[model samples]
Target: MTTIVHNWSMIASGLLTTLVISVTAYAGALVLGSLLAVCRVSPLPPLRLLAATWVTVATNVPVLCSMILLGLGIPRLGVHITLLWAAVVAVVFSGSGYVCEAVRSGINTVSKGQVEAARALGMPFGLIVRAVVLPQALAQAIQPLVNILIACLIGSSLAAAIGVPELTNVTRALNNQSGEAVLMFLLSGLVYLAIAYLATRVGSLLERRLTRSQGAAR
Candidate 1:
């Protein structure tokens, strides 16, 4: 309909915002998640307990509840977060737990002898983690991490519930005002598909690069 044509730009803008939220959240999750995973595997009981608490708390809380708390509660604390930031933080918190577990599982797949070999060569813990352990573990974890990224893409939609004006929100607005429900939803679906396709492609590329390096070393 003419209304759909007239408001196409708004829909596009919303989709772009959604994309940014997902990508930023994915990056933040990776860093925080790596730290959590390390703590979970640490020998110190206190550290492991703290890490497990993070996993349990994050997994138990729904994204909607977390977003409402962050988006609403932060302003009262004089640390006002824009909807964009609130949604980003919530998604990171939601996905980071899963990412941490995946990384731990990947690390488990790595043989202990690799660390022993690194230590036998007088390699420091930092170098062993950076040059030996992390590389292999990341390679093994690529698939599950990609799955987390996909979850992020879907979770980004939750921002709309918090009035973040993400893709679905814009679609709803456009459809309600213009009665072009089918067109707006179709466009929104395509945007999601594009994001999913890109995530999958990047995962495949990383897998290939890691595999090639692994083969070269062997």
Candidate 2:
């Protein structure tokens, strides 16, 4: 306990790093994935192909391999990025594939009639998607999207491999210094649990609010 109490700042910083990575990565995944999902359902064949190829390749690549490639491979090209951003890019690229799938599935749930009505009213494709498709699709995909975000949070631990000093990495360091492996790991696990619990609560609140808005509209 003295070790934990004394080294609390290190542990807290590690947890903060994990959280920052998770948030930034998840936001990037959502934006990129939404665009990819739109392209997947686009009228243009080339756009569809481009988006589909990205999803296929990103999903197939191992997360660690992606991180390694981004971390090491890009440096050889004379473009330098930090180990942390490399991890963020890898996570966004990988997680976007799953996020795209979830969002596309949600888009499918939307009524064809509504889209047709929007088209009949002379709404452009972009406007139709923005006004009619995305809102409903987002509501439908909320749960799955939350799951992906949670997975991203857990996956962010992989950043430790590249020396990110995130929760897992710092916990390993703490364990080495304190020689209390079990205690260090237990504390790390609790931090992860707290993050996950907070995420679930936020997700539930969002879900309830969306439900209420939908009910009010009807």
Candidate 3:
């Protein structure tokens, strides 16, 4: 307890670091994942194969292994990315596979009739995807997308393995220094719980809003 009180600043900094990594990684996942989703549904065979291969590789590789490779292997090849950025890159690439699948599931839920109608209207492929597919697909995708974000939050702890001073790392240090493993871990868990609760609440609000908009459209 005394250690916790004295080291509040360190713990807070760790929490902030965890949040930064999770948020950045999730943002990158969304961008890359969205592109992959598009590729999976594209008319071209080569693009579909490329996207599928990326997702398969990213999904199959363990995050720790990927993190080690990103943090150490890349630098050995002459790239100079920091440990933090390396962790972010690993997370982004790894999470993108799940994101792509989730988005593709949403896209599948969109009515084929609407897509056909758009095509009948002579809309270009790009226009039809943007105007007809993405909106409803995104609405359907929201829950799964939020779940992935939560996974990202928990997975950010893996960054500690690569020497990032994230929450788990801070908690480990506190435990080592004070032998207050129980208290330090309890506090660390509480921070994660609080962040997860907020994220869930935000996701729920957005889901409800999207649902209402979809209903109004009908």
Best by lDDT: 2
Model 2 RMSD in angstroms: 1.1
Q: Residue-wise lDDT of candidate 1 within 151-184, one digit each (tens)?
A: 9999999899889998999989888887878888
**Comparison by lDDT, 2 against 3, better one:** 2
Which runs of model 2 end up more than 4 angstroms from their true locations? none
Say which prediction, candidate 1 or candidate 2, comes out ahead on TM-score.
Answer: 2
User: Which wins on lDDT, candidate 1 or candidate 2?
Assistant: 2
Q: In model 1, which runs have C-alpha deviations exceeding 4 angstroms?
A: none
Q: Residue-wise lDDT of candidate 3 within 6-58, one digit each (tens)?
A: 99999989999999999999999988998899899999999999999999998
Q: What's the lDDT for all of these models? A: 0.88, 0.92, 0.91
- Per-structure clash totals for the candidates: 0, 0, 0
Regions of candidate 3 where Cα sits further than 4 Å from its true position: none
Score candidate 2 by TM-score against the native: 0.97
RMSD of 1: 1.6
